[model samples]
Target: MYSLATGFRIPVLQYGLSPTESLLTKINGGALAAAIAAAALSPPPAAWPFGVVGAGAALLNAAPGPRSIARWGAVGYRRLREHTAPASMTAARGETVTWELYPDHGTMQNPAKRASFHAAVDQALRFVSDQARTAGIQVHVTHHAITGDYTTHTQTVSVHIPKGLVASPARVLETLEDEFAGLGALMRVEPEPIPTVTEQGSGWVALDDDRYASTARITGWPPRDDGTLIRKFLLGDERPPRDAARDVVPERSMAVLYRPLTQRRSRWLTRIQEAANGAFTTDPIEKEKIAIESDGRHDAMVAGEVLVDVDAYITVWGHNPDSVSAARWTMTRLADRHRIRLDWLAGQQHRAHVMTSAHAVSTRKGSVL
Candidate 1:
């Protein structure tokens, strides 16, 4: 299951629990306790812990050394430097350029695997933008990819700069490393092995509410107990979202496909719950919650589909800005009622170009939000 990127050996493993048949045999032989003893004796599985597949992918993306992290950072700096080199005229105008960096990693590297990596970087970039906007920072990201001598897979890194946030590459890397390190630890992950984050696919562009095309990675949910749950995360044709091109979006854009929601959607739901005076937390609320999560088809969501919990930034494009008024009203009214300060997305004004912020999730589809 290994692949090549920079001529290094990448230990390839898919998402979800590793094979248990060997352990199962021990259990059947009435030696399960001994096996557990052996594992406990072997060492806890790495420094990171994730639920099933998430944990596996996280582990695969672990950093091997500081040199690796620096490589990715270098890649990000290159793009940022190129995209937003301070113009000599910018100085006299009393303008400041700021740059922000966000780092992401996945263990299972794919040499031939193009789509998933691009999607991974996209998801990570949006997550960073969503956080920064909420914190009142203007940011643009440049990607990076890093490699080891014998590894066949590429390690990805993306740096977001606030258009001249720092005066020098060294300073930028220093500041970004500190911030992303904290995020990685908070997420129970290794610090990004900063490298050139190269995107290998055509990339994604949200066409409209009903359809999102040119997207690299997409998450889907199919209520199946089979292994298809993990396959979608690691491998697939990268299908278009159902109802993406139609009048109605069949799937909820705000909901992270394979990942669960803890902040963005979950936070919104919490506010609604609180504003409703714990209505969502109580008996009636539980039912309401169930209704939203289960908002999908009744039949199988395509065979061999994988379902994992993810948190992402959902964008809707090419919609009539005027029509978003209803959605804006709904959100604002909810905010007022709950006393929650909801912010609009940047690069958007008068419903024309809304971006995200630190406290709220950024979504292109307001109706879904």
Candidate 2:
């Protein structure tokens, strides 16, 4: 099958064999070889080797045999299944249901006006989260700021439904619509069928529907006391997260996963490591002791280091190569403004796009789709 999204060809027999098939093949082949060897034996004493082979074959062919091997294979195969399986093998595999949220108003540059825009966005996210929780769904919501030739800034809530639960993709979307009824913001939910393909290095993956993605690993951020830089990073100084509310948010999205070090032990260790790496190879534990003994100030006691590991991913929907190139350029520029150093994850873009669509939440509505 040819994928409308990525223009990649899907191969037949994508998943070569299942647990039962593999085990049976091994057992049958082993039995055949043992039978041939036994038949070829010149004399009874020469049949010892053949006897051992027959014994091994008996173990594999025994009633309820190969069960142990099959169990182990299943466990190991789960990890490989995602990369080897076809999307259609499961009811709605690799399908995505996304909700795009847009505010009612237009672009506003004034600080006060921007504040109002943010407030509206915050309320919308809260409302959606509350609704999902009530309906027993755990959704992942992300906000994006897209600019350049095509401008769009909006928050998107995505859910991925498993095949076992849902028979049709539209039904899953309808459930979400029911939950999102009466939410003030203009919202649209899209049922997207991802293109499944096997790519070098990435293995099997579902390409985002007519979209390309890039990921950035945030290497550094503004200091703790620098509110200006922090604000700009979170809500760009001139270009707030919702600055382009009036402009359509392209069928594009960006997700920022932030992990902040809050525990005392973790924070101290990170600070010590950073200090040690910046200066000498002296053990951080030893350096802490020396600083405490000499200066009467414990390195861990200092409140200077507040580290957050941020991973940001941007997805852009474009119909052709030229448009895709433009979308990538716009995302690159937007990322630079926040001082976020990034490495494009081109190899895993398709998989990342599917999983990060927040499909983890759709499992709650069993059989609803």
Best by lDDT: 2
What are the lDDT scores of the predictions, listed in order? 0.29, 0.42
Positional deviation of 241 in candidate 2, in angstroms? Answer: 21
- Across 81-107, the per-residue lDDT of candidate 1 in tens digits comes to 432112221122211222233323432
The residue-level lDDT of candidate 2 at 254 comes to: 51
Each candidate structure's TM-score, on Cα atoms with residue i matched to residue i, is 0.23, 0.38
Count clashing pairs, candidate 2: 1
Whole-model alpha-carbon lDDT for candidate 2? 0.42
Compose the digit string of candidate 2's lDDT tens values, residues 115-171: 665454333333333322122223445655655575456666664533443346466
* Alpha carbon lDDT at 212, candidate 1: 25
- Predicted structure 2, TM vs. truth: 0.38
